[model samples]
Target chain A: MNQARRGRPRDAQVDERVLRTAAGLLLERGYNGLSIDEVAERAGVAKTTLYRRWPTKDHLAVAVVARLQDDDGIDDTGDIRRDLTDYMEKIADALNRMRSAGRTAGRDDRSAGVVAELVAAGARHDDIGEMGRQVYARRNALALGLIERARLRGELRADLDAAVLLDQLAGALYYRVLVTGAPVDRAYAERLVAAALDGAMNRKEIPPCP
Target chain B: MNQARRGRPRDAQVDERVLRTAAGLLLERGYNGLSIDEVAERAGVAKTTLYRRWPTKDHLAVAVVARLQDDDGIDDTGDIRRDLTDYMEKIADALNRMRSAGRTAGRDDRSAGVVAELVAAGARHDDIGEMGRQVYARRNALALGLIERARLRGELRADLDAAVLLDQLAGALYYRVLVTGAPVDRAYAERLVAAALDGAMNRKEIPPCP
Candidate 1:
């Protein structure tokens, strides 16, 4: 039970410094190379302080990634297609960045790299898994809100499954990175949004799903 | 490289016996509990023989899951929606089964379980990752073929991006299991297929994306 306790009084500056130092080491050295002792030394913090905060390397790694995801805020431009595409691109860019961590700089590696370890970290620790779900739940709520607003504006169907739609848009990027080893980018995001918004069925005289 | 070379002579009976024994241990013992020595001993095969075949515990685990996936044959019932729903259910069923591994029976655990380790296994080894991609490639080709048949029959758009469609369908399931800790089942699959087939956009006068 190495979960970080909520509402623990802490120095904001120290927290930020530790995270910055940890993130740099993670990206520069990969997950296997990340060491708590090294991070403490580099950040000029006591080892006990970092351990008390993060507990384990997995916890530290998940925190580093959770912070990155928090910055990818969704934008609303009234156009569902365009807005969704922009959001998907932000996610893809983040995934690509994480996928590049710990690999040879110019090798063009297709592996999930640190991204896979983050997912595994969730599986390994129940608290990390809960934290990850919480992180995504917050982000998903925003995306769902965007979809709900569009539905209200008559831009989408009245019965649109916003959750499933979000899953499709975000899921495809993860599927490519984690499962299929495929590339995800702006062009792919456009194609994914188009397929999801317009659908595959021939719309000529085809009635929508009941 | 820990890769099982292609065209290498293998005893079909021994492979099946070893895989069945290994699968039992994996489901009962979980990923961390799985050991190569124990598998070789329990399967009554020489340690050298098992090592020559699987090379590592991760390879053995991947092989076990790959065999399970091989049984999920896609049935082209001609209705793309119905067929896709059925295919998705099979995937969800497999995911659920793996999600329950190494946990108390009927405990309703939301973690990804062995599935997460399998994904990490691929990330840890390039050979396993390539093997995983090949497995998905074969299965995806069949699903893509099903989508292609619908498109050819005027049931879907002529310019449908089959690959993205498949990604959306399968990706959502994996995303629920791996990222969100959300439940994936038959009912959700129905909603997913419906959303993917018909789309979220209001279709009265909206032109499809070019």
Candidate 2:
């Protein structure tokens, strides 16, 4: 019920100022520290002006996260292996840029803050949770495309669901973010691709499609 | 050296009180919000006395986590597969406990605060960041024992490294946790045991060791 209504009229410059400031505070102090007052102050605007557009902190944060730059599309090189490699590298590159952006611009905390609360909010999007699935859905779409191509080429199991494979791949990245401080670097990316492409069996043969 | 030195006689009872209070605080507020004053108050002891034992918050938190009890040694029925199932089941039980515990005790900003800090500290303890790895190590140790038996029975490839196999088995669990939020339940544990026992590649035809 507290979701911010979109499309409030504003000075383009002022709207841009508010967004950039909110994004900055998210990275700096995280969700608990972010406030409407701070966003208004950072934007050098009136509190009434900020409240006129957004209804809740969750809505504001989600909007900011929704606006984050993510991988638009995977570059397909035709060769399956090379395409996967390129895809991983691009994803890895995006991940690194996000990390660095988090560190320098005080943005990472806000990004993660939104993710944690949204996910914890479960299906309750009204209370600061609408943005939870956007990033994950984007990842599944990209990876499913890769796996679907591989399945067509007879490189993977016909029975293996693209959804499952995508889950395994994205899951590793989320796991790294949550539990391990491990970087999603090119090498690790390559290893994950290898594990997905070829099961961790020591045998050189790929599993015959079921 | 801000490290506290108990200049007098070392009392094991005092150390026990310190650990118990620290553990309670850790489970409640986590590392960041947990303070020396609170721990002492909960333990019904003086702050100076708690300080004399812990010295720093990081040191105190580590000690508290380290002291928490772990499982009874695994039940190995001499079959690696069954042994792994039971072992992972124990782990699943623990994770279920933590998931609930994390949620119920989810007050205090420590969800991000403590987990982030402690995971980053990456300090070597038998129990800290080793949360996921410990369960794997125990399972792998059982698998190594199983693989050797399988080799004698002519069921395992000669070139297989037990350590690598163990990593993949556990890596699968980590993958699931990261992606699907799937519990390492009885079913998942069985799948892991099977995949590890029989290669993900149709093991009936038996791919040769690479």
Candidate 3:
């Protein structure tokens, strides 16, 4: 056990290097181009060391995404609409980045790229699916708290379902990217927030029809 | 051309049989289990004939889904909430059916199954992606028309963004099925529609703090 303890520091360093290399490769080459062999060669680590850590490329890819998503912290500035819109912008930025990753600059890149692959990977493997769900759960909890605060503060409706609100906001972005092949930018984010926050029912009285 | 047209009736029959057989297999076995060979054999058609209609299993699967979704006609009862809820229920039913397709009875089938596979297939192939977008376009046009009618009738806001509203309604359903692994049913659909149609902002007058 003591002998194994001696290698722990070196193991941590190797793990960082491998993950950095893997992230670069995944973003540069998309899911298909990310080869474990290439990652080991670039990271100056043995294949056994890489396998010992990540076990498989899918696991390694999931880790890279987890790291990439670490910076998406939600901020509650007491203005629920602005806060939610800003939050949606952050999500759109991450999704747009993932959507364009690992393709030639001039080539057609309308496809979902590595993002769709990671989603499919989650469906293909239970562990990956669980990890993806856990990631969403943590992020959603933060957003839900933000919504709850708004509701408590009388900013949002008392009967609002925070989870459903978040779902509508985030889900529209995902649906656009993954299904509709539509572009999601800050302007679109603003429109999405406005639509969700303001009810679509006619508030003004209409003139009687002839 | 006339001679080719002479085989048109038989070809249409074969197409129907292949699609029906493929849909059955897809529902029974999920995506991976719907083999082309098996579909051809079960349809009692030659392998080449099946191949001529659907070049690959993904193509066949897409055709099956397109057929499955052909009957999702939206109802215009003049009440936007009830109409949209009914529309959403239709979408949820289709998604729930796909989510549970090809799984053993009483088994845990939370995975996206065929839905995620079809999404991935769209990302993997351009033609499939086009077909998917076209299907959504047709369906969405109908829903948008319903929304437009409601807007004209003063049920919805005159300045409402119909596409955004529809996106929110449908996007939430897809997001739950594909990402959150949440159960989407009539009850959930009702809640979702209510959330979208009724704004989340607090409408009641807030009493001054003591």
Candidate 4:
């Protein structure tokens, strides 16, 4: 109640400080090292305040990621290939950042780290799972819209399944990071977009009418 | 040493019994309920014997999944569409099985279940991660060979990136099951294969020669 009485300005400041401190700690020490008490102390906020907002480390971690993802806005330049490639590269950058979190420079670590923990957190709790899915839904909706626009404009086939195409483009990045332990970079993103758009089936030329 | 002296017959029996019991427990209670002690006791094997085979529950779970995946053999009927669709369906079936593991029948539970646990297990341990990657590599290699054969026969474009094509196909299924909480099925598998094999670009017919 007293915190509420302190009002909007103070509350915003507290949230900003807490999240910044938590994000730094997470990137430095990974998921296991992100202690709420330490974050509260560093942020100059009470433990009660942090817990009242985030509830658990998983919540705090998810919040941190939500903030990071919020900055990834898709732009539609009317060119589906370039647009999709840009979008995929953005995703790859975010994944690469999280993948390299808490690890030393110049050292090779193939561990999924905080990314795996975040997925596990969603699977472990129903509310978190719902929240994570909502995040994906919101982000994916934008990409889906972009694809639909391209399809309508005759850039893509009229019969195209936009959702599946988006899934293929985004899924490849996630698969490399989560499953195959493969590297996802701009080069890979370009290749993925090309393969998906051009497709695998060879086209046969129709005979000219005499 | 004594067990080795007991010969191949007893060793095969022990492995079969242990895996069967583990799979049963896993399906009934999910990942958390699977304990090595219980599996060993139910299988009538020494705890040491179980440990010697699978060092941890994660190892046992991975082994169980490996057994499940082993039955997914790709058939090359020279028709890439049918083969790819069949392969995607098999993957969907496997994903659905793990997705439903430890949940009540007909109950709506979006939890990824044992599949999530297996992915986390791979992330947690290097050896487990390597083994999981190897499993994926082997399975994908078979599918790649199928795609390559189709390409050579002019069924597909000669310049198609088989790896990227495979990634899109398999990655979409995993993405749906693990991230979006979507239900993957045979129908969805067919759509996915169609979208992948057929390019998304709008086709423009060449003008007839005068």
Pick by lDDT: which candidate is best?
Answer: 1
Listed models, DockQ each: 0.54, 0.13, 0.52, 0.70
Taking the tens digit of each residue's C-alpha lDDT, what string does model 4 give over A52-124?
9999998999888877787799999999999999999999998888877876643356666677778888888
TM-score of chain B of each: 0.90, 0.61, 0.90, 0.91
Q: 3 or 4: which has the higher DockQ?
A: 4
Query: What are the per-residue Cα lDDT tens digits for candidate 1 across A1-210?
Result: 122654533566677788899889989888898999999999999999999999999998888888878878999999999999999999999988888887884545668888899899998889999899999998998999999999999999998989999999999999999999999999999999999999888878644555
- For residues B122-154, could you state the per-residue lDDT of candidate 3 as single tens digits? 888878888888889889999999999999999
Where is model 1 chain A poorest over a 10-residue stretch in terms of lDDT? A1-10
How accurate locally is residue B186 in candidate 2, as Cα lDDT from 0 to 100? 78
Best by DockQ: 4
lDDT of each: 0.89, 0.54, 0.85, 0.86
DockQ of structure 1: 0.54
In candidate 4, how many Å is residue A105 off?
8.0
Docking class of 1: medium
The order by descending DockQ is 4, 1, 3, 2
Candidate 2 lDDT, tens digit per residue, B110-208? Answer: 122333334333322323435533433454565577667755554445655554444445445544443234445678667665545543112234565
Q: After superposition, how far is residue B94 of candidate 1 from its true place, in Å?
A: 0.6
- Candidate 4 backbone collisions, by pair: none
- Ordered from best to worst TM-score, the candidate numbers read 4, 1, 3, 2
- Model 1, B60-174: lDDT tens per residue? 9999988888878999888898999999999999998888887874645778888899888898899999899888998998899999999999888999999999999999999
